[model samples]
Target chain A: MYNILEFTRNRSTSVEQTDDKTLRSYCHLNDTIMEAYVEIAVTIPDLEIISVQGDVLRPHKKEFKESFEFLKRVIGTRIGPGILKIVNGLTEGIRHKQFAFMLEECCHAVILLFTKEDLLSSPRPDDEEESIIYHRQMVLDNIRLYNRCAAFAPGSRIVEGIIPKDKDI
Target chain B: MLKFMRNKIVGIEVKDSNTVLAHGFLDDNIYSIEMNVLIDINHLEIRDIDGRWNRWTTTECKRAIPFLKEAIGLRMEGDFSQTVRKVIGRRACRHFANLLLECCYTAKQASEVLKDKFKEKHDVNNVTSENNSDKNVTPIISADMPDHSDTPFHDKPVSFSMVIDLHMHSFPASPCSSVSVDQLIKEAKRIGLDAICLTDHNYVWDRDTVEDLRQKHGFLILRGNEITTDQGDMLVFGMEKDIKGIISLAELRKEVLESRGIIIAAHPFRGFLTVGIQQIGLTLERAIKRPMFKYVDAIETLNGSVTENENRFTEKVAERLGLPKTGGSDAHEVSRVGVYATGFIDKIKDEKDLVDAIKEGRCLPTVFRKHAGLR
Candidate 1:
């Protein structure tokens, strides 16, 4: 059999506390080769963007090259709800949806990393059943974590039968 | 390691000359659901539907089974996806909706086959002639659902005199916000908000513009600023200074105190509840020890941007520290303006009244919209 198409994409994110009050997060996307990379520095607690930079090393299209210029627009903006819309509005007119996604992912990684201390300080569950119940309740408590990680994806044990409270009828 | 997998299988059978039965089975590591939908061959409308959950994760999963009845009269026609979403997806399990959509798709294909068979056997010119005449058939799902038209946007607590969304941003002031000032006011009124405060990041609304807006819309529009301090964000009311960029929390506190303004810790515990805290030793005692808590006058316990758990945590810390709780949509868009709000026991006529209310602990966090669902 002849294969008509072959594709594989991988994304990795990392955060480093550059200073006592600053966190720098980086996201890299690779589709067979290096496709896109974004780095953002935000202040702790406030999570406001102090600096941002990105490059489309292996462009999916030539229009994506213009995406780097719009990165400055995100500076001074906080990494929270509506950030994606803000990024998309700032990067409009360029085929830069992927770049916007990468920037958002970088912001999300910074937020997750900032909360790592709290996660590490939580008490451990006694058994597997208890652990499942604990995690399920955790997702229930914070529905924003839904589909954020593999463990919370739809149909996963942790999120199964969990109807989002805000689902518009 | 391979951790989880899910399988969905669907089958369609001709139950009779006028009926087609479509069966859908979904099995995974954590859930097992089987559903059967009986579809009319001529009209393509659902005649009957049934489902069962052999294995489920939560007790609430069973509550979704009864919602399946809403799909019985739905037609597998134009905009069927939206109808199914409104009917089966919203009030109950989305997995059930997904399975039902799949079964409907298969039933649609089976209906096509039956139509073809009818066309061949009866020498019919148009098997869909009857179905086409009922093109405007409205599904009963929407009418059967609870009416929210008369319901207030937020669930207000008794004894509260005025409701106000204390945290909101607008375009040109807060670059992240998509809504303009005019749009925000209109949306706030449309959603039944008694009043709204524009608390843009580092930018305070002009007093004249606010006054004009209040007069023009006949709605109370208050002014506040979301200051970015080194510690965190603070919603400062009754401050008219147009401060920009990040400042020290101490400096912000001193200024607010000097101006006789009230400061609220805005989503103070955001990102703290993203992980499972059961495995972490971060308790309320440890959380309350945060330095910023000493500076703010109140805590935003029902912020739209943060998770319910985060809001609850903030609420707990507020209770522990003897601080008043407030709510705000922190809305960048018009639609989110009143999702969460502050219910003031005393009437707030202007920014001073708002400040006085917060200073006197006359306001409590009230949720207008249950979920902001923003990311």
Candidate 2:
């Protein structure tokens, strides 16, 4: 078991050093009752998405697995200001808002990993482009806050980031 | 087969437009088909009555002839074949379909004559005229759009005075682009660009908004789309609709050919990364060759985001294939605007003019190290 974890860690390191134009990142959101994960492969210098794989694991594990194919449609997406809307569009006919939310969280985490840390809070003026990036970061930051909350209470309500303290789950 | 061989069709030798070709048996006087066609391409009209069938009188086949008049308002250029198909291809009168096609061929010849006269009088070979008729099709004298022959024409003047970036992305539409339209405009103006084209991934900016911005900023804005094809990416101009990531190279080629649109291969040598399998050699050796290379108008030899080696490889392939070359900044962020551009000898007024110039092979790729802040 320990060797398997170490091999996976070394494999990810090898992928990170593969190419200057391509970057692969993975994010996992987990709790007691349900767990969600997403892996995003994107091009650098320009964030053209190559592929995405994601899934939700809940009490209805079979149904959640069926909805996993939603993210596959976002293969050739170019991630920019409208990332959330594209994510929402991926889950359009599935009528799965929970899937959309989790997929959005995964997308934010991948973008945050790719973006330079200084650019996140560069003190730029509140223009439309700058605000859109900031909003993406805020959602990522809120997910971190929620993960910390879920650590203590595994089944705590997931708060909607824009409206403070409003439980969306 | 014997009956078809016995049927005799005699085309009368007449110099007039209302000439008729009659079909009859060798000895019988009864004529099965009498086709009278008058074609005037300059006026863009075709007059033929619909042919309908009646078992009692054996006259239903004549009703399908009027459907040929649907070709009245169509131009006899890129859409000539499509217009012919829509008129008499499948559900229409199968018997008279060949007759309608023959009429169209005659109409096309007339249009060619008019086009040559206009070209000689105005020397409007490379530039689009103010008249709306020239907006869709270039002159037949300069009928240089897509031939799949891979013939290279190096006749353009070496020195050009105008510079324009042919590809860039805008926020909200290209979800991965970090630059907004306002930011791109400001950056292009600061870099002394004569014009800039917005080519967001799979999306086009509204014409009205681009026109308003062009007037306000006093800089030219050409509309284009960076279509994501299965082979790679392409920069397409003169496509009225957005077919970004959904179209294949073959389908895109047919659509672009019919629409007379210009297509340039975007960053043809940019290699993608595969897990655990590294491309150890130069990009030129490992680059996935696009099968539709012959159909593209030109190769984007200088993309700002790609490495210098990759750009050089693209140039080498383009030279070997006898294709013209173009360049673009491929800017997703604001600061990268005008990093690379295509220089044209003649000034371009709109997207149509730009497409004509590229198809004429009167433009060259240029690199701008100063504007990209690399200097």
Candidate 3:
């Protein structure tokens, strides 16, 4: 139930706490999925993932939805049946990607982490990496926007009051 | 008894001896057979093979198979004992040794629980547990080509270097598979290697050897370890500590990613035993079904010293999958040090960057030595 969502971390990951609304506005610029994920992540005990929310994220990321559905289809399959197809697909994709990395001379990927605690009402297995990545990306853009907005509204207690404790850092 | 030739004029027979219980075929004549004494069934096994001990067994014969095989072996060994020295060649010795080893391994395995299998043989245990258990990847010795080129051999070998063999007990540590770390490094330097991973089975290269060598050679030595999982070997970079027999491949992946390291599939295409590659007997036919390109990262293009067919089979799989492939020496010997290397096209000036480049797939696998190609 505990999480420290990342913002594409660097050496300077904040050791201090900051305002909530400001965080939302910051993550929204990256994508709706992250925004939605972060919005639900904090209230782990209360939030329930409904079809309505799923539909919202589905529209936001068609690729993720397609990948997720295909993954779901493989749940009950015996290891031998779909393993070849899944493995071949993965390796072939990687092969093409490797060639591209050499030719392009660079490589990039966007990864996200989502915890089952936020998605499930009952206890379930959680992937901390997925949750952290999801929240990190979720916070990235919104943090950028919030920083800008806070710069102008310097007097707002919501932004200015979360003191950056030197000791905590 | 089955008859070979019919109507023999042996004075002992009252009737035609060939016409008995079951039927038989001959030169324009058919006959039956029933009574049995001893069978010389060399013909029926595959039909007319000259000198084979092959025979078809009924249910009755099945029960006695184990004892029959042992009896035959003991009889042969005893008969050859008196002057076996003159006739014994490599084959006889090998047969004798393999039998002994099988018996020893079987007895040990039966007495102990499977969990206790890795004890005593610390080096092998470390390698086996750390390199192969609970991992989702099998090392495949295969060659991969880019879409731009269907063939890997069209161009000359690419040149670059990255960490390899970290999981092995380094040269100064335990000498198992091939060469010492020192010899490996020397050979790599001879070829003007930009870097040598210097990793071994499961343990880290002793810190002093690396520190001394790094200061002297001025080449990049990346941190690496080859992990053993249930599926196969995973050549992992930028981590230390034994991850062997501790977690499943699924679990390993989570840790590997979180640690910000790269995990490459080791020799995915070469089949023996590591992953669930079935024993090659009645099960060989089922192999053609698994398209072979299923899971994991960069295939091992050149394993420092396997046969050409092993390498070629791997190459075909990489082509079929269009996967970003890599090569490693899989070297345990010093001479094989730089035999297989990876070329990272990135600005990876050192170990960390090298990992980033490989994880990103900005590399080419190459086999510098012409030791093997396709045989």
Put down candidate 2 lDDT per residue, B13-81, tens digits, no spaces. 222222222221121111134344443334444433343232211122233444444544445455454
- Candidate 1 CAPRI-style tier: incorrect
How many clashes show up per model?
8, 17, 66
Looking at model 3 chain B, report the run of 10 residues with the lowest lDDT sum.
B43-52
Please give the distance, in angstroms, between residue A37's alpha carbon in candidate 3 and its true position after superposition: 52
What is the lDDT of every predicted structure here?
Answer: 0.69, 0.53, 0.34
| Per-residue C-alpha lDDT of model 1 across residues A93-162, encoded as one tens digit per residue | 5565557667766765654443444444433333446556767876666666554433454555767787
Ranking by TM-score: 1, 2, 3
User: With candidate 3 superimposed using the best TM-score fit, by how many Å does residue B282's alpha carbon deviate from the native?
Assistant: 13
TM-score of candidate 3 chain A against the true chain A: 0.17
Estimate, for each residue in B63-176, the C-alpha lDDT of model 1 and write its tens digit.
Answer: 677768878777876677667765676545656776787677656655554566545644544333344345343433321111111223335446778889999989988866
Misplaced by over 4 Å in model 2 are: A1-169, B1-157, B272-289, B369-375
Off by over 4 Å in 1: A1-140, A146-169, B1-157, B276-280, B369-375
| Candidate 3 residue-wise lDDT, A1-169, digit = tens | 1122111100000011123211110111122112111111111111111111112222365543443232222221112111333322322323222121111110000000011112222111144345434333322312211122211122322223322211011
Evaluated on chain B only, candidate 2 has a TM-score of 0.54
Model 1 local distance difference test score: 0.69
Q: How would you encode candidate 3's per-residue C-alpha lDDT over B14-103 as one tens digit per residue?
A: 011111011111110111111111111111010110111122111111122221122121211222222121121121221122222222
